[model samples]
Target: MAMKMSLKLNSLQSIWYCVFVVVTHAYLIISAFYHYHRVRQMDWPDGTLPKPELGLYMLCVTAALLITVLFIPTQIFQVGNNANDRTKLGVEKGDQGPPKWKGGLKAKLVFVRRYTKHLGPVGATMHIVSAFCLLLPVMFLQAREIEHGLLPPQSIWRSEVSLVPVIEMDRAPSPPPLIDTDLMSTNQPDLKPHVKEPPYKVSMVTINYINYVTALVVYAILYGDVFWFCHKGFALLLSVQLMFNAIQYSLGFIGVSLLYKLHTYGWDKYGIPEPAVVSSAAGLVGLFLTNNITIFLSAVVMFLYGYTRMKESELRKRKNNVEDGKCSVVYKGNALRCQGYIPHMGALCVLVIFIICKSPLIVEYLRAFRHQGDPRLLACMLYDIFYIFFWAFLWVVFALKREWNFNFAYLDEVQSVKEESSQSAGSTGSLVNDNGMKNNIELSFVNRYNQDIHQRHNTDKVTEVKMSPKLHVANNMPVITQASEKYSPKRLRNGSATAEECQLLHQKQEHEPIQNGVLNTSMNGRPV
Candidate 1:
């Protein structure tokens, strides 16, 4: 019954996975058509579209199609492998009994799950590669915009020109003495001339629209993983990307607002058109603001979810350590892992908000690139390139440094156990006998045997003795002792003892018998 339920759940998940893939491909197809139409409508003043523009749009469509194609095998293989793992584990646990019925839909599902595991990392690699490839065209287009000044300058107010009505009045006849008909007709004031100012053109609106769309597609590609996988590193990178999009849109909105304000104050004087102001304001609120708010909210959500996952993993690790008996004195320091500092989720969220609000400065800086010389543009381009590389470097560093599943505390536990075992083994080597004295009987016999041989070899020489208040011996050998009072010994001629030394020695001498040519006992009746 459990096996059946497990299979049912797997089938349901696989069905949803299939639906997601289908919808993704469908969206890609729609996007391709949209871009194709956009390319077709794009016209050049010379009646011939630029080759680069046409090619870029076509490449976008091609890239979308390529992503869809690349996703299919990965989806299929990933689902199949997941199902296979579930099946194997379930069967091993005795949840899966003998097959009840064969050659049915269940059988087919089982077969598909088990047989498709060989494709392996190919699918996962393709999935990641496709995701990475999606960003290349966007980066290229942004670089081109920076190079060619395709994006509009932000200083729209500087272009305003005042419109003054020019009135030409025929010279009035002096005092109108005689009403000459032609002269009186000419004196009538010409109808006040109407002066109109051309509407302001904002160049950034279209580029902002394009960027919003591109960012949306990229977000969609990462959406499933961010929610389902909840990988912290991936979440962090996603947050960064969303933060960038939000900031870019917000700045675009600011530019639109500036244009609106200029039009409101100087409309009549500068002849600003109503349509330009209305469109700019509408796009700012409806398009740019909407996208920015959405991306910002999504970034916050991802960060919160990732932080929650981290906390849960930490708790689970501690629980496992308690179960394994590895949580001891050696593991006291295990609470702080991965660089010894816990990330403050609240602080991180605030920082993200700060970035979203203040990143517009970057946009303002880049806006100056067009009005300024190529040097400024080059600098901006370098900054943009370095910005992404910096993020990539951070991602790599986090990935390499992060300790995901393994517990470092367990390593300390193992080391402690080894140290204890070695200590126990060493203590066991020294045995104590029942007599309560250290059992050195065998060592004593060996020392005695060596001393007897040494005494036989040195029988001809008299043992040197020093007069002292206390005397002691070690390992059956005489040891010289320091005297309480300093005394100088006189040198004897012919290497013989002096009369004073001989008399002092005789006062302390004791007679001893020899047995088997070995010296008899000294102080404790042990052989000397």
Candidate 2:
């Protein structure tokens, strides 16, 4: 029997998804142009992977674009266009689509399978090459940065890793994806039933163990703060610090994984291995630059973040019962505040620097290989390349995405406010409070409406800023004054209070809500 498939998304959700696809596509288009232009500009022999590995990187990126595009069904909401709506598949009204079914993990798995079928071997090989190309420099020039004691370059050292022999001190195969021989998979249903699992699985499958080891390693290698502990008596400061580090590392790992998966599983017809590496080189560059660049980015983000809260605090100054459209302080005078996405731009700028400067670790690794006289050997000797542009592009994409999200969030709020205002405008007399003064005339009727909203969002933003008791805020720290406790604590801007305000607002240490005086940390998705 011939089967028909249909997919549908909720109205708003459909728009968001479409926006995501469009933005992603736009990034790809820009990157592609950059790659093509740079390629032509360089006038290198056609099709050779760019040194520092840009060619393969671009190819891999192109493949990723294809993979992402495939999953986005153009017919976002298909109900047979009304005529086909009355299909024989038994789909009901308002059912969201054919068979009126939800595409949960099962659908995702199907998409993944289809994706793999199209991109399996080619993309996989490209990824292998990408990893291979990236490690050479680490093995060569960058080896000094890592500590791998008394072993063969740290690749062959058998600990959690098994394959690539560490040429240095037990350093888990120089670059990584070290195999845990015990856990290697024997299944390769996509390739062959009996074929041993790809070496990548050694890294992918055992990553959890790697994380566990990382934690233990931190415990062994890192020292808890002593001076602060001596003075402030912070009981779990070390634990908190460890948790934050873990979270940061995990996020970085996730970003790399996303890039990796996009290159490997999420590629299109993965062909000649060399070009694929060139494509991913860009992503690698972005990841590398983040170490330095993100410090700047994060700093700016934190500041703008705080500033946004300041704007909110300013807006929320005095005036109880902020009616739909009324003059007060911040929004009272001006409906919207354009702080701009300074942090996102900073992140992009730094990532651009990474892209501009990225080079394959090959030069360094090649030196080591040459010095060690194993020029022909790379235990998993599948050479990959790295580049600056493609890598930086990943960060650029993220930065743009951040902007897009911010834009959408603001738009959503605006639309909702307009709806509410239009409704309220009809019911109540001119929202201009009795001074016969059009208090809200300064704002576009819509802006005023949007700024003033329902829902007790105020309380959600009234979160306490936590600092280890060991860290002290001097009396000179910034201060925030509270007006009244009557209003629900909506997040004013980024919802951060000044240092002094946060200190004053700190939950009393004596009134511990949770065990260990965890205070009212809402990060765990629960109130203490």
Candidate 3:
């Protein structure tokens, strides 16, 4: 049956555009967490706990300053005063709005509570961003038609427009297996050659504009009296993308070592069957060789090598921990789930196999729907759909992380549960007595349960110890805990401090572990 579908911008492709976003926005997310964990471990002039919420605030503030004020056009063209108006109602005392936003307008003005604890609305904001990204392109197109007198621009206010992609996807059957098919001519008719689809940059531009708008909207929400998330989530994403690009570009130029390259090539070329690397071409690739055994072989070698390297790195880290009794350095986690990671990689792998095997299924789909059935024949298009979903999913994850980075309403008083009962053998004193002075050194190190990075422990729980020497009175005595496992900082609340203190504390958090601290910091950085 013949079928026709119009191609449009801003549908599935919008998903693709958001992929790179995974790299940048995730950075800020990790940064928020870093600050959270950092603040938890630190100690200030008073015997108060550090609030991760400050890092969250810094991030939200940054997002607001950069995106809302800078990237977006100042004049908001959208209709209405804003659908998310919750502050008009007179807020009474005792009711912590949404259990996250900790203060009223007056308290917020005076740097009332430790970081803005209202994290609930951020999820809604993320949903809005995703929906906006999907729908804006369609609106822009309608806007275009209005400009050309084909459609009215005011139609947006009405129900005349919808945000669905125009492309029609016809699911096609899988191609006959290469081994099962006959090499010689059979009863089946020869198929027509396939051509590249026409470019859709117009829609792309529209998508770009919408993305800019959505980003700006998110930026503006960072400091709202109620709930907002942007800061570290956005920052981490940017940083991750930058680092990945740098590494990829570097790898592209140097072309992995010569011996390494030769060893992989040798096995792939002639079933030498030696321990080899993974196909160097396995990850994100540049040039590809399809319908050929050579590239496929290369992939196997590259895979082996990659696997070996990963194993070696893990072993090295293990050895260090065993000998030095010091924990290994842990890199930040990626914002997106790994499901996207392997699937995207799979698409590339499948691409290589198709090149070598020249799967007949691809040929039939092209013949059946080159005009209307191309979606069926094109595995790449399917890959395109998956990639889009991956990006959007990552955006949601990044938004959640952004919230985690900032919400500090609960930091007022964080009590440690240890009570000097469960201290390890190598544990130091809970209370240090000095000459004539009473030192009430409390082991505020709270109990931490987390997964073990090493393969030694199969279970996903570990205890954490907090030893802040900064609050120690005696110069000779120091707060120390056995370095058996990595320390997970315990956060108390989000707070504020002087800019000088912030920078110094921020630096210390990055390098040395936190000692002690507290301040009621606002999302809009202040001395509280």
Compare the candidates by lDDT and give the number of the best one: 1
Query: Cα miss at 528, model 3 (Å)?
Result: 43
- Clash pairs for candidate 1: none
User: Which digits, one per residue and each the tens of the lDDT, describe model 1 over residues 1-528?
Assistant: 123432223334433544564465466456656755664554424544445644765665567567657655444433444222222211121111223346877776665554343122233333333432332233333323322334333233321121233444444434533657575465544455444553443333333233334434444334323322324345446546554544443334444333333333333433423323233323323543443454444444444334333444444543442222211111122233343233333334434543553344345334433433323333434444454455445444543554443222332343343334333221001011222222221111113344322221122222224322212122232212222222332111111122333234323333534422323344343544
lDDT, model 2, position 222: 22
Q: Give lDDT for model 1.
A: 0.36
- Candidate 3 wrongly placed segments (more than 4 Å): 1-528
The TM-score ranking, best first, is 1, 2, 3
lDDT of each: 0.36, 0.32, 0.29
Mark the regions of model 2 whose C-alpha exceeds 4 Å error after superposition.
1-160, 164-209, 212-341, 352-362, 369-387, 395-528
For residues 54-105, write the lDDT of model 3, one tens digit per residue: 4434545355334422212212221111112222111211222213335666
Worst 10 residues of 3 by lDDT: 469-478
All candidates: TM-score: 0.29, 0.25, 0.20
